[model samples]
Target chain A: MLGAATTPAEARAAFRGGAVRPTAGIAAGYVQCNLLSLPAADAFDFLLFAQRNPKPCPIIEVLEAGQLESEVMPGGDIRRDVPAYRVFRDGELVDEVADVSEVWRDDLVSFLIGCSFTFESALLDAGVPVAHIDQGRNVPMYRTNVPTRPAGRFSGPLVVSMRPMPAAQVADAVRITSRYPSVHGAPVHVGDPAAIGIEDISRPDFGEAVEIAEGEIPVFWGCGVTPQAAVMASKPEFAVSHAPGHMLITDLKDSDFQVP
Target chain B: MLGAATTPAEARAAFRGGAVRPTAGIAAGYVQCNLLSLPAADAFDFLLFAQRNPKPCPIIEVLEAGQLESEVMPGGDIRRDVPAYRVFRDGELVDEVADVSEVWRDDLVSFLIGCSFTFESALLDAGVPVAHIDQGRNVPMYRTNVPTRPAGRFSGPLVVSMRPMPAAQVADAVRITSRYPSVHGAPVHVGDPAAIGIEDISRPDFGEAVEIAEGEIPVFWGCGVTPQAAVMASKPEFAVSHAPGHMLITDLKDSDFQVP
Candidate 1:
């Protein structure tokens, strides 16, 4: 098991040396970010899209044209820093690669977005059970009826990830997670799935469904996959993103994101 | 005096009808935002700059290439909504106009940025004296030695606005304004002006300087003018911004921005 004691530099070094695996539990105390790289032309629209839908796409760092290393995560290379990257052309996934140095371009703008993983750490610390981790499964995600405010060429519905917990623990879960607004803060909906247009909680649109014990309720938070969904819908000419669960570990601690 | 009872729509109508004045007291309860417009090409860079340096340039709303109305202040027109605009070309101020309708272009992108005026109201409400308002002078502004993170072509020294208040009230002033992060939040520096590179407490780079009483400390917050200074330094081919004290009024109340 990759323990919480690992530093962000260690995790990135592992990813750089052909370690392709989920980043969960590695560098546990630090922030793990979602990656989105696009050509300069489409960069503005995507940045605007994230600005309009901040909950799902809380921006941690943006590496602009001609820049490869992040200011927030110094010494990390954007091209080959992550363990895995998904390449898409005209919105279709074309390749999943371990290294993207060959495809890196001077005009490519990279965005490091906050992931829900940071807040999940806070939840676990506060004694709120995360069902998927206990069952060794991916957290359930759903495309909701809620529409994100459109920006330029991007327009799509809000996407959310769910975790089931005891009804009594819901308030505590909300209070804990709300402190990290950059990492998909607080539950968007608490009790009913159908209210947000998820007809059946048993089948999720992405990731595996987890069991909800008796006296427990399902809670949803804005998911990081949301911006990817919007990118896919818009079908941009070219784009790159970190594969699900394979995030870029940053030097920043999870505590750095907490509201003071 | 324009009272809190006035709506965004009503205030906009007054601006549209050639009411050229400071927007401070006009929209008593609503948010009044700083305006900056540029070509769509420069829009991404400016937005990225704001994202990197959020404290000084908190984006209240951004209108993309084709859009003219803001989502936050619905039904308001971007071209002529604000009472005044300062047109710039290659870093030099060229014109000051009451309406930008004729100058508006299809490719122009508009940004509505949070102004410190919103939080000044909060400070006053908490019984913390705002020296400039009480004495009927412009809030003192200075360009600090601190540099803002560069985004694309936008980069410059951090600019801050100052207000003098009793040393005992500094904590309460911070507590009240910290709730509104969308505006410049809390004091960037307190007690020592020279620490941030302000040579003379009695002189300011922009706006009128007010007296700092013996018992009061000069508190500084990130100023909204920082973005404009950045724009000027970058020498973007073309740009439009509201004259310093003039602002675009939004429907969102000052309390709407409070995090808790």
Candidate 2:
């Protein structure tokens, strides 16, 4: 197993070599992105969907058809960069593969979207404690009643990640995260669970729940899972996405997403 | 003539009533946009181009194929919303009409992009003196060597608008405009005009030139005319855009585009 001390290149090589199993916190200070791959016929709509919902789908880079390697991240192979990929047929998960080389097609278009991990670093830097990092658990995520802007056949409710922060540091959290719009910008909602239709904050739709201390407010941010929910709702004939928590590490620095 | 006192609804109503004139400073506080209408076949490429060059082309709303009215701005007819429309055929200027009702087709896709007027309000609010607004001249613009990120069938050098500001106020000007990313955002280049390929700032490629006073720097922001230049360069089968300064006044407020 590759440890957290490995360089991004070494980490990617390990993943390609079937040594790294999941990329939760392997390479620090680098960007880890969610992947969405679809056919050319659905590319325009998916692109438009991301454009309309930038908060949930902040695009880091888009790979045009027939291009496997990202121009921004040279030597990174789209087919083998990540630890795992999930193949979906009509929105149903059919297979989980270590490599997607055989299923790769000329018509495939890829999108790299910003992940919440970018802002989690900012939170930690600002002295705000992250519950999941301390407990070695997944960050809580939930499907909300918030409706995303419909584009073509893609239309669904928004998905959000939850983090319990002390009320005193909520403002600082907002300020720091707002600087990184390319990653899920600022908090969509703070202090309330019923408002966004998340009936149970302790029980999440995805990821393990973490402890919320007294005087801490539960904050919500647009999640990368949003596009996946949209894809599942749309029921496209074919699609591929990185398995949850198995992100493709990019060459981009966390500061690249910051606004001046 | 629609005056600054006129309401947005009244101005749009007047525009639809054959009031074929420029829409500059007509509806105060409302967002105005540059229009780009293209065949559905070319919609994907144009959308991608706008996505890549957001500073020059901040897409406010995109009316999909067969849609006549924008969902964001209700009851507004795109076919006759703007005061004037310039039609291009095979990349050449073919006609300038008051309305595109006769030429409108079902396969057409319309994109409404942010205009500088949205950010000019921000500059004025910040007490930055706008020379063109005071002297009653159109903001000077020029084509520069700064190349835009090209998408399918679209590629060209960037176009920028120049505003002369006292050296001391340049920072304030940048700080204010950076808030409105939907409206050309911040300055792409500040200082020496020749460095960005503008040999003479006095002689602009579009709009009347304004005099640069002593201790002033020529600050340049990406211009909305970039898409028009790219469309002309790409030589598409057919395209339609708003004539200079004749923009589509949207229901969105200038304050709405502000970051915080």
Candidate 3:
């Protein structure tokens, strides 16, 4: 079970010991979160950014200044729980570190955001095919013409992750994903890419592109990459985030957010 | 259609001309919102408070500093739209005004929160009898032992509005109200009010108490009065809010939030 842990605590312990990697497919039934930590000065604006654009930046938990253990995740440590972390200084990637203890500061506040993996799992369980996963590639993502509502100094175009499914199952897919509002909720756009101002479907701004078969339509959901895009555009002096593909798995089950 | 106008624009016009009163049951189908305004300096903490305790402070729209018109409500003016406004200074009620224009400044941030009347109306429409309405009294409310997750300088106990409903109809009532998450959503506590620190079912901390029938149970939902409670507890230098029972009618329909 070295690469396959069943609980978030076990996963975090492995991560803390420097014996873990990308968290997808691990902790299969648990919730995995995208991490974003910023200085207290910018925390308000970043939180406001998330509030204004909840679709792309659905907040799972926000830690108070200097606090590391998550309110929602028991025994979760922000500094050492994640397998990999990326540091940003003035909007540029400065370092990739396994643990941020040396760079951690008392003024830093952390935010745990919802990851799309939760909904993707639900989609797969409902018999909907995910093209990128079927091809063993990263999900296709694109920068859209749709602008996010601005908050303080944080504002940028929305970034979305796309999955292609047959036109007949689009309604079912929407219904399934809508149950997980905390995990990016329903699709923002479900049809043609050009309608949202994407020039080409083959080349994505980030992630690998996938094939869309005949009678299939491109479905887009708000991606967690949005906050990072906003951070890059705003150019804050310092920030910390989980490395791409490396997530912090929490103790809560994926089905916990299925509201009545 | 003097009193039966179904548009927010007409309602606001009437409010501005000193012709309108409490907004409940005025624009029958449109959404009505609770208003809160604070200086720019305190806006961050208040917004964080609302974000942390979403059940009680489900924000419908947030206006940027010095901005008057709501992003969600087209052509709505914050200063003159609400029939009655309450000004609080140092956490004490200081003035009740029709127009806040004289006191409005360039550093004020306004927020529109969902009102419970939206869900109450839905419950009534679904054939679930509301005890307070049936008895022509205000819904009872209580200060619970449950404390809201604190954010920034804001922290306080949870305040809940109570309604007594027959046990047989509780499930249907919950289902009907769960559709509107932005407007105080589903009940926080159902049955055995004492479990959540209510000692007396016959008395309430706020509003009028209604009789709980022999087969009925006391159900509680997070109340919008929560944010105001936080404001009072934190003792901010200045704040503005809609007078109790007086709300801002928005153009959006109540059914717009009915999700899958």
Candidate 4:
């Protein structure tokens, strides 16, 4: 029960006591969020960036500057809750650690963004096969030709995660995912890598590439990596984010966002 | 023909030349927005307020500080586009004018918020008769006991607009309006207004009260005026907003938000 917690609070508690690993399969039924903390000076700009591009940056919750506990996840300390965190300075990754309390600042404003894992779980629940999850690999992510609406100094190309499914089930997959709008809802693109300016399917900009079988086509959903890409491009003097694949498990269940 | 323009641009052009009045039933096919312009210093707080209370503050577009034109309504001027604007200083109305060019500042950020007109249009299109519109009166708005999630200096009671429909048509109205998430997607309450702490059924804090016919239920949806209430309560030093019922007609159509 140590690594396999059933609730988000338990999972966060476990991670708080030095559980430094990815959080993919932990707290299975809860909502997992992508974390982004920026200095108060830049919070408005980044928030505007998220507001302009909601598909890739669907905000779940925003903790006011210096606020530790989220209303959604009460008594949870964001600094010590996540399994791993990556610290950046001048747009470069300077440190990756299990606890970010050492570097946390009073003026840092945190944003919890919706992740694809919730929708992927929904897809799996609906019997739609997720190729990357099936292969025990990371979902394929690519940089697209689509430019995000710039806000202040933050601007970047849209990043998307691709999952291949049989052409017959694409409609069902879309239907299932569309219900969870807060979690990067619905596929942005369905059939072509070249259409969104991707040169190769095998090599992804982030995450591991997976196989697309015969009779299957690549479907893309707006990835949460987009804001990170903006942080890299815009070079916001200081920032904090969850490490790749490591996420903050929130107390809310996916059912909360299931519109129907 | 001059006052009966069918396009958003033409309607805005007419308003620019001192055609000051309410914008209901104008350019019926397009969307109308509630305008809220604040200085750059208060932009973040207001934006955060809108984000936290999205049901009542669905944003259509945000024009940055000093930015004149919106990408959604190119060739349009923010100062001269709307039929009427109410200028407020320290939360008290100072003037109501058609053009705000003289009072406009270089650091003012304007937010175009989704108005109920779009969804009301959709509801009427779906054959769900709206009571207020039937009587040619304003939708009754109430100050609910439900407190909105506070953001910075922005916090106030959730204001809701009521529409009475036959019990048989309530479902259709909800189903129809739910598609337009950008313009208050679904009803927040149906039936007894006392559930949300409304002491009087006939009295409303804002807008005109209309009759709830026999066999009809009083349905309430989040209203756009919630932000104005916050402005009144929080008392920002300076703000500009659309006069009650006077909205900015945008180029986008209601169908654009009519998600299937």
Q: Tell me the tens digit of each residue's lDDT in model 4 across B1-260.
A: 43435688888888887888788878887888999999888888888889889899998899998788876787899999888899989888889998999999988999999999888877877788988889999889999999999998889999999999999999998888888788989898999999999999799998898987889999999999998988888888989999889999889888887765
Best by lDDT: 4
Runs of candidate 3 with Cα error greater than 4 angstroms are: A1-4
Superior candidate under DockQ, 1 versus 2: 1
Q: In terms of docking quality, how is candidate 4 classified?
A: medium
DockQ of candidate 2 compared with the true complex: 0.55
Q: Output the lDDT of residue A207, model 1.
A: 87
Candidates in order, TM-scores: namely 0.97, 0.97, 0.94, 0.98
Could you tell me the lDDT of residue A222 within candidate 4? 94
Residue-level lDDT of model 2, residues B1-260, one tens digit each, is 68887877788888889888778789899999999999988988888899889999999989998887875567888888889999998889899998999998888899999999989977888799998998899989999999999988899889999999999999999999998888999999999999999998889999999988999998999999999999888989999899898888878888889885
Clashing pairs in 1: none
Check candidate 3 and list the clashing pairs.
none
* Model 4 chain B poorest ten-residue lDDT run: B1-10
DockQ of each: 0.76, 0.55, 0.58, 0.53
Error in Å for residue A194 of model 3: 1.5
**Candidate topping DockQ:** 1
Error of 3 at A59 (Å): 0.6
